[model samples]
Target: MSQPVAPKKLRVRGMILTGGVAAITIVGTRRSNITQKKEVIQDAHYEVDMISTLETRRAGLMQARQQWERKAKALQERIDGNKLRTIPGIGGTNGATDGSASSGK
Candidate 1:
């Protein structure tokens, strides 16, 4: 009878230890999943922010490109005007082949 009682007690203690181990494993897995989910959410937010920043920079570059194009066009117009002024007989009806007034005709 003494031997049988000792075996029963040992079985119960073993079952309790097994149950504790199972519970700890489950809790650890849950915490790891939660941490992984949080990391995924943070990564999603960072991606959106990065995309928005890139889009803003692209828009600014496009605006700067348009402004430079306009400046280039203005400069080209000034250069063309200077070219026309340098051409002889293109300024007026004056017979001066050079950029001076004619004495006779």
Candidate 2:
């Protein structure tokens, strides 16, 4: 009887796995760096965009106050608007502005 042919070795599988792990490692490192840069603001979990928006809102509040004062007797009823500066943990409004941290132990 003729000898059976030997099974071929699938060596390409190892190379493929190595390539995939390298790609994942590069991508994960890049993503981690980007995420870390985003979280270095003064406020707790406040991104750069959030701080910019807060600045804009403060400017708007100043303009609103000016307008409100200009029309003192315009028959306006007393109403409390959410100034957003008082909301806890909302739009960079952390409960403790005294530099206290609440991060991982």
- TM-score winner: 1
What's the true lDDT of residue 52 in model 1? Answer: 100
- Let me know the TM-score candidate 2 reaches against the reference structure: 0.32
TM-score of each: 0.77, 0.32
lDDT of each: 0.91, 0.68
Clashes of each: 0, 0
**Candidate 1: misplaced stretches above 4 Å?**
87-105
Cα RMSD of predicted structure 1? 4.5
Alpha-carbon error at 67 in model 1, in Å? 0.5
- Tens-digit per-residue lDDT, 23-60, candidate 1: 99999999999999999999999999999999999999
**TM-score of candidate 1 relative to the true fold:** 0.77
Clashing pairs in 2: none
In the range 24-73, model 2's lDDT, one tens digit per residue, is: 99999999988877766444556667888999999999999988886763
Estimate the overall C-alpha local distance difference test score of candidate 2.
Answer: 0.68
